[model samples]
Target: MSWVHIARKDFADAGRSMMLWALTGLLILAVAGISVIPYLLASDGTTPGFEDGVGFLFSPIGLLIPIIGLVVGYQAIVSERESGSIRFLLGLPNTRRDVVLGKVIGRTGVVAIPTVIGFLVGAAVIVALYEGFAVVDYLGLLAFSLLMGLVYVAIAVGISASVSSRAKALAATLGFFVLFDFLWEFVAMAIYWTVEGSLPGFDGLPAWYLFIVRLSPGQSLSAISLTLIDFVGAEDIDLTAAGRVAGEVPFYLENWFAWVIVTLWIVVPLGIGYVRFKNAVLS
Candidate 1:
């Protein structure tokens, strides 16, 4: 069988995603509470529009998708090694490269498909509450959200490949989730403010501050989604950003390059990990 076969077989491991689904369910509940409950309480007592119901999902809900992705991918290669299954898998004609690639594909499908379904369910709720919306924009949002999840899946799978022990892989994955998702933005802001207080304030802030603010994957995805889809992330600054061309702000601050950053999160991690996994000795 081909790598696709391996992917199908691995995707049968879907029973393991209870934690991811729990988090997603909470996010959907958050979306419902934030978007739907309020709309029902409005003066007209109607559901909010597409942006109101669906847009906020891009923020708190979208931010957590990477965590779901990380959970899905954290055991991709390491679990096999831990169970002594890699030898059985390689007993067939499949190369380690095939196993790696298939795991990426299988796990990406596992994470992404549910993410899209979640968004679709949200979209359906939005439509039920409000007037109909532009389906194109809705689908666009879905696609982008799936892609964003894929980025973190790649990152987590990369981590899974690099560590030899299951404990080490779990520790490394959690550390990554903590550093980038929780700490990085806060640390960046503290430094930014410290610099501002030490200097003249407004004019003292560097031009790159805008870019620095979006260094995390969540921020980058939020910015890019806001840029690409007007109705998806109403609160993201890309919606408020002035000037459409270069010299308006740093290119990194622009949506297109923000997209590149998101893509890099997917590509760079997977590439580096691929090299590591390929070179790894399968004991």
Candidate 2:
């Protein structure tokens, strides 16, 4: 009950944030553009329908939602602490858990709602142009995208709560963003390069290679999106023909497991941060 009030307050407050509005606009524009461009360029036959357009958005959404989630959550606690309003938050009959949970819920809404709406708008465009819509794909994309957003919101809010300063929180969150978003791929590739000589080309790479990619939250989200959305003009999840030929890469490499990975990301960070926030004395 108390968490609801806190979450409601934060949700209402987002209305005044020009930066959020701007980012939201950018997200919408990017999504809509991705959703509509192919139809515009298609010669009325070779091009696919709105379903394909929405599916096309999977990659971009997987990339952009984390940034939006970070923006929404990075300052959840530290900004309030810097402004000394976190004390005010704590003063209002709120426990550390309540504050943390409320912020996570509020920030999740901040990123997820806009994202789902953008995709829905794409669906509308598809319906109008194609005269039919893939409701399952539309809904699944929204559901998974929402889950992905919450996963990152949890991570960002956890970082915010665990840190003592806004700068440190921001740095940590951005570092996390980079770690999952870009660094993980590079690190995996480096490992692959170092070990490639021992194995045959690409297909001969071991299960541990896929394990390293699975370690990243972004990779997990992208992989989850693959399960929900049928992408057009995109190849199968197999990165190489050899991976396809490898005959069931590994259990962790499976699509359904990506959702499990996302769930872990949501829980683990929030748990760590909640413990830290519960123990720390809020000044």
- Best prediction by TM-score: 2
Encode model 1's per-residue lDDT on 233-276: one tens digit a residue.
34443332233222456656666777788888877777777788
Worst 10 residues of 1 by lDDT: 237-246
| lDDT comparing candidate 2 with the true structure | 0.77
Tens digit of lDDT per residue, candidate 2, span 161-252?
89889999989998888777888877887787788744334555567777776778877777777667666644745653226335565777
- Model 1 sits at a Cα RMSD from the real structure of 3.6
Quick one: best lDDT, which candidate?
A: 2
User: Model 2 misses residue 118 by how many Å?
Assistant: 1.8
Each prediction's TM-score versus the true structure: 0.83, 0.88
